[model samples]
Target: MKKTKLALALTSAVFASSAMATNGTNMIGIGAQSMAMGGTGVAAYFGAENLLANPALIGKSQGTELIFGGTIFAPDVSSEHNLGEPASPGEPVGKDSSDANLFVVPSAAFNSRINENMVYGIGMFGTSGMGVDYQDNGQMFRAQSALQILRFAPALAFHNETAGIGFSPIIQYGALDIHYDGSETQYGTFGLEDAGHGMAQGLGFGYSIGGYYDAAPGLTLAASYTSGIEMEYKGQLSSASQPFAEFGMIPEAFDDKLEQPAEMKVGASFDMGSLTFTADARKIMWSEAKGYKDFGWQDQDVFSIGAKYSTKSYWLAAGYNTGDNPIKEQDGTTTEGATINFFNNTFFPATTESHITVGGGMAISKKATIEGAFVYAPEVKTRVGVSGIGDDYPIAGAASGDYSETKHSQTAATMMIRYNFD
Candidate 1:
């Protein structure tokens, strides 16, 4: 029972804040400085936080340092649908906001100079996930789902006056839970009950490699690549529960694995006296991923730009980031296509595309610094199920005009404290 409760807590946290993430299911940045700077850290140095962005930057650390932080993420999400007719009379066709709205993500890192030319560090961060809860409202088939991912990375870097390179071996833990009440829909009376089979958990391994070069005085360029991690959650996708078994919606032979997509990034930072500018561009190969590709997710290209001004005691930063939504509406010409489209929008609405960020840092003492950042993402709307439903489909009142629309927006605040040791 304790394990069940823990699973439920993890599941609820991920689902509640899923849409608050900016780039697909990923947070725009890891540390308060990075978050404030529009997630552009590839070519920039921001103390120990560099462990997650470009480990090579650790070589630039002044001395042993420890940084800890958390983000309060809040998402505003709502769904409205008129899918032909309700299974029971008097069900309303209107929009309703999800009660799940807030979550906190934590991060910490420790880095030290091993020698004159080498550095080592370890970092733990909440990396990626997606989910939503519409259970109480029941507007979109009472769907609820959550995916949580965490990464533990240990890194090593070697550098000289002009260039540096680093590598980190990554261990990732993931949890997934999917539930819905299809019984009240025009579709067949079937759904994956909440906690019916418990939450599915797995671990996977990957690696990140990066290098940076000081092209000129006050100018740096860097690039990095992260490998994909494949994980399988036993019994989660292929459970043989009663309604799921009877409906035969998911074939028993289906694979239960979902692979995190690989990422490639390149960035540059220019420092001019008291001001600095940074820019980055990255690509996420979702089309090549396993579960995501099967569900019609496309590749995403993300771009970020930021600027910072610094004085002896304080620094202020601002940034902008944009990415195209990876999940696109499918041409539901076949029953199978329509079903896949319905599931994609209803359960995994990773549709946020833009973010604006601002932040500042203050030196409270000779060895202690505090940083804070705020991020906002404008609302984005998407609709699905408009394509004609074939006659062969088993739903009772589903019509060609039946469709569901979702609106998602987000706001988050991050705070971090950094302590330096002589």
Candidate 2:
């Protein structure tokens, strides 16, 4: 039995390193389920370890079953400029705003009980995804026209309990890409077009250890902590206008490495007759991370919580979370007035908090379970210097206009199908 379990763990870790690497729900949790539950799996089933939320939550269940699912994600944004000075909402010269775009994602998981007390499973889920299109139209219409940012992860887990405790170690894989166009500040608005240009890309890796403890009958508490990974990316750099010019190629000196923030995670679940209540808290150590390499960046803290209720026929859950921004203006960047700049923030953002989620599960048959979930996460708003598109800026061109922040939001849904094989 020990040999078989050991093999499973090694195989799971190996698979994880080759596939995905993602972090935080929104730099707060991992995904919708954890996000719906205040950011961690406190009351979740110890089934497949596919989702990266909590590696310890995946375990074997009686019956041979297959679970397939998907999520549709939508993001929105809004920005207000020249604040403190007071500006009209209809006035276009001072502030501008737009939505990122809608995203459709899919997920799958398979779980099986090795015996009455052992379980193992694997799943494929989205760790993170980002997109923007502020420049689809003409560049002159806005101060800055651009698009950029991406970070994603996929993982696996294991669980077993005869009465003592359950343990799981998760391995993660990650990759991020960023791009953006340069914008300049004019009379009262940020200027747009290929004024400046640049691109940055990176690969990251990391993992965590987690476990479950049964303090009472049908009641257990789970805890897991993760250390972030760092990735230094290199790409082409140039002004929006002079792409093939002197600075067309990204300079080695300007190339940079950024670290994922470390976080402490805690969660628990209580079974009450036919109901289950869950809660979770997490503290992301953004402070441990470094600012952007050439442009400069700083990390921020994140917190979250969630609850769930279950019955013989079905189950429902919900949660919320908040965090600090990682974007900061550096003292001396290449651009004169612009102290420092950021090209891509998929690995970093100024507004990294505030999310709400809801989801449920239903029995499809005596041996199968079907589930679905939805989340509403509005974009965050912040200020930097003079000109700012929303936070979802493009991948290239670090210094846009100066002194301004951006806003962003997210809305998404997920569905899962599972079969139990005893």
Question: What's the CA RMSD for each of the models?
Answer: 5.4, 10.7
Candidate 2 structure quality by residue, lDDT tens digits, 287-323? 5564222223344454555667778778777777665
List candidate 1 stretches off by more than 4 Å: 1-19, 86-94, 190-195, 240-253, 395-400
Residue pairs clashing in model 1 are none
- Residue 379, candidate 1: alpha-carbon lDDT: 89
Cα TM-score per model: 0.90, 0.67
Which digits, one per residue and each the tens of the lDDT, describe model 1 over residues 190-236?
A: 34334235688999999999999999999999999988899887765
C-alpha lDDT of candidate 2 relative to the true structure: 0.45
